[model samples]
Target: MNDEASELKPSPKIDPRLLELLVCPLTKAQLEYDAVAQELISRTAGLAYAIINGVPIMLPDEARDINAVTVAQP
Candidate 1:
């Protein structure tokens, strides 16, 4: 690893390219970025994927659930 690599802090923004490639690991569905919550949400599957310090928490146990109202909508 380079010196700069170690010094790099986690980014708040998810790269457009990276986002395009990212999927909800549980369902393999598309993920929506919630900048305010810093989470990658999968409405289809009712899972809210968290992004801590810019790195995504892909673990199922780490994810939160969406509300009933939010999930009810098409």
Candidate 2:
């Protein structure tokens, strides 16, 4: 049986080799792996692509705008 805490712990789903090979689909630029956030940050594209279930969602539409700012409504 696996330890409950260990099982619950979150781990990076992406592979190191794959990370090196993967790039921003839009800009063809290098991507920075964010293990904590489970995303690939593309500075050139100014986007953060979400990695779900060990799969990187490289689609632009699904990516979050890293440069976008959200203002709180008072």
Candidate 3:
């Protein structure tokens, strides 16, 4: 049931070392990468920031809203 277009591949442009410096702007929480989900997860805020092509989407709208309900639905 997964959408092919929704699949986000890790960007060659993103430096792994730089990922260490990227923090969630909302909650200021450390982000962990979910390669399968192709997102950087803010565990505190429960938000998933999309990786578009090779770029990490730092914008708010580009981020997916997440919650227990959404997780359950997904």
- Candidate 3 lDDT, 1-74, residue by residue in tens: 56765565334455678689999998887888877677888888878898877688977667887764633553
Q: How many clashing pairs per prediction, in order?
A: 0, 0, 0
Enumerate residue pairs that collide in model 2: none
Score candidate 2 by lDDT: 0.93
Model 3 error, position 63 (Å)? 1.1
Q: TM-score of predicted model 1?
A: 0.72
Worst 10 residues of 1 by lDDT: 65-74
Global local distance difference test of model 1: 0.84
* Candidate 3 collision pairs: none
**Estimated TM-score per prediction?**
0.72, 0.83, 0.68
Candidate 2 vs 3: which has more lDDT: 2
Per-model lDDT = 0.84, 0.93, 0.78
Stretches of candidate 2 exceeding 4 Å from the true structure? 1-7
| Candidate 1 per-residue lDDT over residues 1-74, each given as its tens digit | 69898678445798788889989888999999998788999887888988988788978788898864544666
Candidate with best TM-score:
2
Better of 1 and 2 by TM-score: 2
Ranking by TM-score: 2, 1, 3
